[model samples]
Target: MRKKRALAGSGAALALGLAAGYPCLWRHACLTWGATAVEVHREMPGDALLPTAPLVTTRAVTVGAGPAEIWPWLVQMGPGRGGAYTYDWIENLMGLDMHSADRILPEFQDLGLGDTMRLGRNGPVMEVAGLDSGHALVFRSQDGAWVWSFGLYPSRHGTRLVSRNRIQPPDPSPLYRLFSLYVMEPGSLVMERRMLLGIKQRAEEPIAGR
Candidate 1:
């Protein structure tokens, strides 16, 4: 009886601890991960992709390659092409049907302004909004509600790949907005972090036959 009571007490304590710590965890995930204040505040070329003020997320990684080496991977990202370089199982569970590419495919590398990419069979998810070859690419949602941008800046060793996401959720009640913020903000961070790391790994890998 005593052992059972002790176990129950410990479980309750653990639950309380998690409940208390959740807000801090959520804030860290939403506001700052792999990003500095300077990177977050600096205006990126793709900022003009959206006209409205949005909840912005900025994350970055350093890759041991130049922008040119990294550009091909970004260009080929989508369903039925090079998949989003995140956890494919999780995306598949969400019905995204992602199959992340290991090698750059020549066919998918010619992306241009106004081109569309699908998330699944569910129609267009992102449209090329603006691009500067070997430097930056920005994609906006078909409805113009979200903007995701990738920018590569020359660093001392290689390149700094910065990703910025700006989101304007559809008009909803204040309560619903709050709920969406808590859910979507952290979710985006998790997926985007995986994507950044995936791109970094791919970019740093040696070129085949070279």
Candidate 2:
């Protein structure tokens, strides 16, 4: 009886804590997960594309490998190419046929400036707006309202893989923007956090014969 009461109290406290932190969870904390102050505020490669974007998120991870080791994984990311390195089931549920590859795909490695990566089977496409071999890659939506970039910087541990996104939302109404702050912000945290972890895991794997 005493243990049950203790557990119930603990649960209630947790619930109350979450409620109190909802605002921070919505955007403040979610937007900068795994990112240092410098990374969160620094200018990324594709910032000029959406200079005045209202919603911007900057996330980073320290991969135990060099940029060249992780560059292939980024090159092969998308719905059809090497998949987004995320929750494939959740993505596929939304009609995104994502099949994450376990190895580098030679065919998809030639992603170029004019290339477009379709979001899903019939989803809107994002065009490759910038690329700098093993250092940076940026993509933008056809309407020019969203920009996504990956910047690689060498670190003492290994490498700092930073992902930044800038978006000039299609609907800028107060309510809509607030809804994004609560819903979309947390959702992005879930997916993008997993993506950074996934890339880190793959990039740190040792070669078979080496």
Best by TM-score: 2
lDDT by residue (1-210, candidate 2, tens digit) is 999999999999998797568876545668888999999988889999988887899999999899999999999899878988889898999898898887889999989998997787776689999999989999999988889999999999999999998988788798997778767888889999989999888888853222
Whole-model Cα lDDT per candidate?
0.83, 0.88
TM-score for each candidate, following the candidate numbering: 0.85, 0.87
Residue-level lDDT for 44 in candidate 1? 89
Q: Show model 2 residue runs off by greater than 4 Å.
A: 1-21, 24-26, 207-210
Against the true structure, candidate 1 has what lDDT?
Answer: 0.83
The pairs that clash in candidate 1 are none
**Residue 208 in candidate 1, Cα distance off native in Å:** 10
Question: In candidate 1, what are the lDDT values of residues 1-210, reduced to their tens digit?
Answer: 999999999999997787567667657556557776888888887787674655778898888899999999999998888999999999898778789998899999889899987666764478898889998899988988888889899999789899988878777688767676666777778888899899988988874333
lDDT (C-alpha) at residue 42 in model 1 = 87
Relative to the true structure, candidate 1 has a C-alpha RMSD (angstroms) of 2.8
